[model samples]
Target: MLLQLDCLSTCLTSSGSVLFPITAGGGSLDCFSACQTMGYGQILHRHGNEEDRVHLNVGGVRHQVDPDMLLRFPHTRLGRLLLCQSEAAILELCDDYSPAEREYYFDRNPRVFLCVLNFYHTGCVHMMEELCVFSFSQEIEYWGIQELHLGPCCGNWYHERKDYIEDGDWDIRSDDQQHPSLDSSFEELSALDKDLAKFKGAWCGDLRSYIWLRLEDPGHSTASKIIAVASLSVVLTSIVAMCVHSMPEFQRVDDNEKPIEDPVLTVLEEICIACFSVEFIIRLIVAPSRRKFLGNPLNIIDVASILPFYATLALETADEEAAEENEDIENVGKVVQVLRLMRVLRILKLARHSIGLRALGATVRHSYHEVGLLLLFLSVGISIFSALIYSAEREVEHTDLGTIPSGWWWATITMTTVGFGDTCPVTPAGKIVATLCIICGLLVVALPITIIFNKFSKYYQRNKAMEGQFAESIDFMSSVIISTRTNRYQTDSQDVKDVFFSRSSCS
Candidate 1:
């Protein structure tokens, strides 16, 4: 389908001379697209025109694009630009254009234009990682492309940016306020003051915001650093108490012959739980979004670490005397103790502070496909090898490979090459099967490990990149901001509009 050119009447430069290219000497222009042509469709000759070519200079990046491609979206500036069939219309696009060259120039970001160019060819928009999402979003609006037109890759990034911005992670500023002002504004606002404001977030007007900042961001202030250190200390103390409490010396037999917990260890764990409970409450209270705070993984870890302590206490208190006599209560107590092991997950809480730990976490998050593939490979190998090894050893008497399930354990151990020497085949056929299993296991395991490692390297690089680039993006935001002070002007505004776009689309 072709884009309806209702605005064809609005194309100012689309007079006869611009419809087709011509040499300065007055012969028909000769040009060809050396770039790989893509897709299959009659869209190229939809209008019954043979071919229309343009020598377009976007900023400094030049491209020989088909006019028919531009015509696919008639409402866009390029469509209107090429639709204008006159040489003068192309010249008006930029002041520095040399009429003798016949190349239309437009001063714009070449990186963003790459994306726009792709869109004209592909009909879907994408963003570049090097460019700020804000800048990209502005460019999309300028190009008259709706957010719905974003490709799947860029769409995910755009939505993530939206959620993050709402949480006040980024400062949403307009360019109208960034120009040099020597009077009341610049004199009153110090550089340090501006920097602090940028980090202070959109919730600066509220008193709770400062408190939330202290708890949420350790880099916020000295108080925040102290808070981080104190929280880490408490986590370490709790782990130590849990460990010491499990020691043999800490176990004492009471008068009733029931083992009792060491009071000192119990007291230490109680103190740690109390600290965790108070901090979680304060964080939940002051958080900007209660839903986001509650849903956070680290926050969930905090809750899990605290609940185990209380549940264990409740079960122990339910019937202290009945514990030795009642089987149900003893089994229930064992289950509660198992639940208490969830406290060990509290170690993951440090991911909030450690960049390396966060990167590792992200690596695990993104490498799930590889992880699944590894499991699938192992499952198939275990099933096949177990049966093969069982068939080979079943003929022999006094064999350790007694059954298929037993062979499963042997096969698992052999595939991993962790020969415990506890269960192995005495038969040559079984040994041959074990050798084959080991070789297959190495291949299956190595492939997924390589994929997962590559993903780790990728995510780690992105995590590191975000740290250095966030500040640069904030600074660059000023330069790209839309302002009425822009140099370009339009007599017929509806005919054309400025658009920004660029590159290796948000991969």
Candidate 2:
């Protein structure tokens, strides 16, 4: 008999029925306990009685609904609770239901619940005229319904609500206000504030945000573009000045004689330096964290490039004084020349503003493993070929490849196909080794180039796609704002006309 009762309980539970044990005396004991344990026992009892439909009380409105209809959206929170097969709590008074009748209570807006009920019946929801998109979306979310379940009209409104939320335009306090005109204007201003906030750093009152946007962000703002163009021009001009300074005409003749610096180049250098120095100083002063700013490799490069100019000037001054004192100053002048040459490295600063150059840098960084493998293969090939050539050419008189180290130079040139002709393997065996090195070089060099090129293409394509999406989103938002303003203007004009007609009729 016990085994039979256990089998009966399992069969009833499997068939979506509430499990309550029956006694031989025909009296139900622990019914409340069984209902509480089942969680949806009340729903199952109300649904089982086919003679009477269940009634739902939602926000003071009575909705007489077929119990089977509630189970239509079984995947949702409400449906799952009322299906009797799930563990979700349907009500706090689960044990208070009478055997003859039951009424479920819910404290949700009837209007939103109506839409939800319609969704369960027809697989679609329609936002009513009296309901705003944001409020309706909130109800939909609470009901565990996805936004995509809405129709086209509601779907568009849902997307707009999402945009507004992402832009931080919603105001909790304004929800109680009834003035649509004022609220719309306030939301527009809030959206503008959100856009402007992107130019700012996380912390308030930090000027580093503005500096960073102008320097790093590739925004379409006029100020940002102007800064980028000016920075690029400065970098190019500095590079040109360095190149001109390196020409033979600019070289000094003797320790006593001074170098004839071009006045035009000198003026350009000073201007570029002044611009860079001011920018660097402003960045340092406005930086939120001094240590982080100093630690950045690009910032360090900027400082390194700028310091060389001052060092060159100081060294030139010392060299002049030493020449006047008839002291040895040739080495000091050479040091000054080296310092001036180092300033040419400032050309790298242009990469910060150029997307193409930045993409190339990123490609190289991401392809490090492929590049390392190619380099490793090349190193092994160079070593093997160098050893072979050293053995082959060691017997020849007056040969550049007489030692292993000297043979390495020949191997490198041969593999690169540079054929500098300063060193060559004269023996037949050495020639064969040199040929093999050249073939290996050609194969190894192609591998890294292929990897880097693929990376560059992928990054460039992703950037273009992101730019397109950003532009499309901006255009869509602009159209929404323009339509909103047009509607407001029409409403105001109608209100003015009504006021004039009412006064004329009274007069």
Candidate 3:
């Protein structure tokens, strides 16, 4: 008796049934777990070419659907609800069916691929277990009929046009009665059921729909070169102006003893500042928000340059006698000087603003591990050089080399070949140590410098290659857009000419 009960339970489990009653036009409960186990993809039912949609299958059953017939039914709200979670309101009117009914339907209908029972939900359908040809292969020895129906369970369902299903009055039993008989010639149903059973299907939505970003094209990269050159000029000139102010040479220079200035540098500085200032204003206009310009690094640099210039003009014009009485005017010069020097860091914009320079910066950052290794070796060399000099000069020389830190200064000078010649050893032993230290320092320093330069050179070459590729890509895209636009204009030449003249007149 226990074995018989187990067999019955297994048999009942093999047949698909509606787990819940679908309410009419309410909403769809997710069946993603069940759908995935089935052979098909997500159940989307919409009218039109939905080739990209995921399909679905019933568990423990398999069958191929007719493409033409599938197209005719297209997609239903119930299918779409099951697949994409769309058309939720439409699923509120459908109802669900019981297990026994589903088993009978599976046995009776060979053509029945999926049976969906409608509950009270208007457009939603609760999918019953699917029966395909593959499921039939496992049930070859069984004797049963697969009869399927999509009808209401218990409520008084009625539809004026399509409302009867909600009232539970719509009967699909007659439709089920027309299905073919299942094969059941032998006893053991377990083997056939195990072999024939398949899992439910799920829906995978469109991939492109997830992407919403619309980044503006960088435009001709030549534009970047122009902007970068202009920005660098503004930054460099401001830096030099600050440097000249700080340096003794400029401070000491009288009007009569002024050095000749380069006319080229002067013109370049003016041009750069003017171009960058204009660019900044244009960017501020295009910015999504006014605050965005203030927040942006480049925008801040532009504003800083203009602000100092205006502030200087204001401070200079202030009452000269009053300014002389107060030291505030003198302090303003120092603030102006600092503001000017900060412009040099704006040269960083060349790397940050351009894709080509950004790529180069990435390579430089990536090579840091190798650069660190070189630094480590240099540290070791510095220690060794310091020790040698200290050992040779500390005993009788009574020099600064008596300390490690003091000796390191000599090591640094020797390593860099700066050789200021401020400190030299008089002892024979100290001189010999110095000579050997200088030779070792040259090789040790040269190794890392060579390695670093080689890495930089390689990166430069790669960047040039990438720039060429980028240029070609931009050129192609520009040609396509321009040609397309030109064709459109030629097709409407009179309209184009009128619009162009009107725009010219307005300007």
Candidate 4:
């Protein structure tokens, strides 16, 4: 006679409780009844007075739970798997039991199940100190728990494990006993590393890889290049439009004058604004982190440049309305003109997509110290020349340099060789000082320019070399793949030939 060791009965009591029996040969049914009374194998029925109750047998341990509570975390696999209404495969076991009193068994870690159960109940998951992060992560995945749903403790553990994996702590191996050659292994490793980097970057929400490929990478796709080119054209057109708008001929006749609109310029301005606004908004939205996006100086410039266009429109409308209402109302056209000048800053956005501009920006950054020193020297020269001219021209009557402030302006213009002729020294001492200032200006301007140019050239060459190396790496990877495929084909052909000979000999 066969002995039944563990059997779950489909019987339901009058009180709506399931009975499960753990029996051996000729064992008393009293033991099973005793276990049920001790709450070892009881399944609470849905129609019972205990409406939200459920009884689970996990790792041979009885757990009383609330189905309503577990259903709160519908995203979790366990939550769905345990619920009667869930369509998960794990719930199919319920069909073996009576619908009035369902009893299900799961060979799972009771301790871990308790932790998961609590998480569903409390929205908090604590990582057990004894359990390794890797093991816990596996269990979480098995349970269909989302990483985002992890509490702070488990979340940190997950990130630590993620970082370890990304840092190449894991080993890569082939299933075949005959290992690949050194060159092939190296190529495989390189490809794996690249793929791993992309995966990690995406997981961390770092948009750098995506942005670089679309906007900055030298080997840009056709669509990306088209976008870049179109954006460049719009930016250039905007600059030209602003220039034309600033001309004297484009100014209104007076504060009250109704401005004549140029259809072409208006349409062009709108198009440029629309393009820039769309680009800015798209980048901002797709950025991995808003803080990181706003932190970039170039991104800040992009937003600033686009804002003035809308401001100008608003100001123009207000100015037109104010002009008609009151002659005393100040014309905001001048202020709008000043704000429109800021649109010129959009030209800097080219640096994001253009190699030459990027190199130039790098050059400037690298030469910051050198530029600072040059400015220091220029400041000293300006101060000395201003003092001398002020002292000399102060004694002279009817001179623009009669005051120290005026003298400073004269010094600036004279030293830069920008003689507007509006202010000039009238005395012998002042003339000598002005001559010295002009000579100093030439040296000061040329020194910084020469230093910047040298730095720019160096960085430009470095960038070119890096691009060349990148292209070579891509070609080498392609060649490796082709060779590997060829070798695989040859090995398969040899295996087929040997098999054919063996069959013929057997025949």
Candidate 5:
């Protein structure tokens, strides 16, 4: 049970050391904790009233329950109302700091002391147990020297010489081949050529000079080359693709029209195919694994476009009829031609790379249930509209109401309210039925969309409220921790000053 104010007392006794003064620490710093020295078994057996003292032996110290402590620290009182809620708040505060800070704090005090502090201030002993369980490995031990572990101002003191500790003289270069040559044999060079060559060969002899050269122009060699090549390739490919896709052949050919044997078109296709093949080859060669290349969607697209053209030549040598049949196959050689359409996907790719898009994607992914509800509602509309169209359009015989599948085509068009007139209800009753179906379709389609949007709005509002609550909690915790630490520092400083005066007097 949460300790309510039934009694109040303060003991002024000198201890081993003062972490904080009993008063004047400012802003609720004088607050004390209620403790129970008796075990749960004893409390259960005695069944004492709320006013009765329960002397609990926590660690080696016997602490008497002071009901007034709960009144002083209201957070503790509320925390005792729900252990898990208090536990969550403590965990959130702990997350703001690192595991190293918790470890350092736990190491400085006894387990029971931390437990008391947690239960009294945060009202959670489980959090204290959690902090105690984390192991301090060598790397964590090293990281423990940072601001999270020590004073924020003492940052450089701990981190300044860490590299030396890990490995002294570790960075010394052992191979001369790794360095470039300084002396250029080509003496008759222009000013720009001379400057470029000098820069390239600057990292030649001394290790310190090489480090300085790299620091000044990091990624000097490979990065510049990659940027130049990528930019050139993108611009050139886009221009070429625009010209190719815009060609007269991109238009639909009549079914009865004979195939055109245009040498110019074939030559252009061959060029594009060769370029795509070379791109695929380079990707395969440069990639760490062939499996990685095969897995890439664009790489597969490139391969599909180019590889079949090479196969046609082999087919031509084996059997002329097979080659002729391959050439006759509609859209067989149009794979490279389709690449122009893919340029529009670049915008989507850019969005995927952006932080805003990532946030949007996460939001959408989290709201999948709402999205699914909207989709299901749309699907129902489609199904009902399709069934209606099939029933209504079945009598329109000469108007190409061919079958149920064909009726569905008309249904899709009608439900979207597209009213294409490519297929329509011919009879008077069918037309009346179509009009009523259209009206109903619009309402049915909107229902799920409205529901989904409403749910999403509620979800967004709830998240915003939670975010505000979290921010306030964080600010409150920060004030408490800073006040506690500052008080501790001041008390320690004063003790040191008293000790120094005493020593001088003795001397």
Candidate 6:
């Protein structure tokens, strides 16, 4: 700004010559007179870039620099100042400028300036080991050097710091403590917060809130913990029932040779579904935001896991009443089977009670991009190999693949390394293509898996850290949320309640 002001201050007279230039007379005459009083006027004419060396006293450290050499990068802070034609021009660049001693004093950090000085000669900016990435960046910014100028050796440290600040989960804790738009001292914070606050906590609903805490957060109370345990037990029973009745030992054949459903497992499933239905109803009634509760993915999972049973019942009743084609009945049965399979999603309900499951949930939520990249790589590899393999075996008489479309199934199974063997390469050429596909699959799959695993670890570690901080509160159950923190002693814990609210993603 000072340099810009100095440039803009220059004005033209009617003659249109360089009248009232900052280095010459007029407004600068005072600075020139002060120099004369200090004996600077005598040698002012000799003060040019051709001088042998310029003396500098930066933050108490003394140095001698060649004036011409400093002009190598003339756009920088010191470099721009060296362009000054007179002692008056150098006034803006330095403090305590003494022409008699021929030294310029600067209050800036002596350590970082050394790096700046090195850049003038070496044409590279090196970050100091003692300075943090942010501090080093600030110094360089002040010196008019781009952060991109940092050498490759230390670039990772700078880039890593930048990336972490922008994207990492490490800042959640501090962020929770510091309310957005309310960093003022206590009295002002209270005043501002009170004005902006909403009345949505447990106090507003009282008993409903109490019920919500129990059903939602096992850590809230003994009753809630018991409810969580019961919920978990019911979920396990439902899952087990779904699996067990399919076993040959549990099967019963009717007189017509139709398979009869196990009566005991049927009753067990009903009981579990009943428990889930009741729990969902209670949570829905008490949840601060019914829409948000319904919107929550875990809650959606709960509904998904429960609705299948009721739908199956409805379909079974319809089947008895309607005289439909056998194929149509089979299709309805398939639909019903799909609904039943949705019961498997009930295991995600366990995320409500276990931090590990919740962390896994969060990992999946955040790793979508990496997952998409993995899928994309797989798609390209699959398409290429499918075409290559089909072309290789197309002439073969007894090839498993009959068409390019058919190779899709082969390619999918092959790239996934599942190798169902139902569709495979018979020709040696196709086999070689299969080999390359498998290798590419491994590389493609491994890359995303590592990233997803890292995200899982981050969420898991973060959750564990929170659990450690609130060991007493989080011991029995998971409440809800990703990237949220809750202070248990707050006037109402629900002020920042999780949507599933373990608020492992809690605040």
Each model's backbone clash number: 12, 0, 70, 0, 6, 14
Error of 6 at 326 (Å): 18
What is candidate 2's lDDT per residue for 235-336, written digit by digit as tens?
898898888877887655546575567777788899999999988887776565667568766788789889999998888888778879999866886787
Which structure is stronger by TM-score: 5 or 6?
Answer: 6
lDDT of 6 by residue, 173-203 (tens): 3345433422223433343233222223434
lDDT of each: 0.66, 0.67, 0.46, 0.65, 0.43, 0.69
Answer with 1 or 6, whichever has the higher lDDT.
Answer: 6
RMSD for all candidates, in order, please.
18.5, 15.0, 25.0, 21.3, 23.4, 12.5
Looking at model 2, the pairs that clash are none
Question: Relative to the unseen true structure, what is the C-alpha lDDT of residue 321 in candidate 6, on a scale of 0 to 100?
Answer: 66
Q: Over all chains combined, what TM-score does candidate 1 have?
A: 0.55
Clashing pairs in 5: 36-56, 37-55, 37-56, 37-57, 38-55, 38-56
Candidate 4 has its poorest 10 consecutive residues by lDDT at: 169-178
Candidate 3 residues 40-125, lDDT tens each? 11222221245422232334343333233333222442232233222223223122222222211122333332332221122222
Residue-level lDDT of model 1, residues 318-425, one tens digit each, is: 756565766455487577769678778777777776767767875676556778889899999999999999999998998888689998899888777788989988
Which lDDT value does model 4 have at 85?
Answer: 29
Worst 10 residues of 3 by lDDT: 205-214
* Poorly placed runs, candidate 4 (over 4 Å): 1-212, 248-256, 284-291, 313-338, 353-356, 442-450, 466-507
lDDT of 1: 0.66
Total backbone clashes of model 1? 12
Top lDDT prediction, candidate number: 6
Candidate order by decreasing lDDT: 6, 2, 1, 4, 3, 5
CA lDDT, candidate 5, residue 460: 49
Alpha-carbon TM-score of each model against the true structure? 0.55, 0.50, 0.40, 0.46, 0.36, 0.62
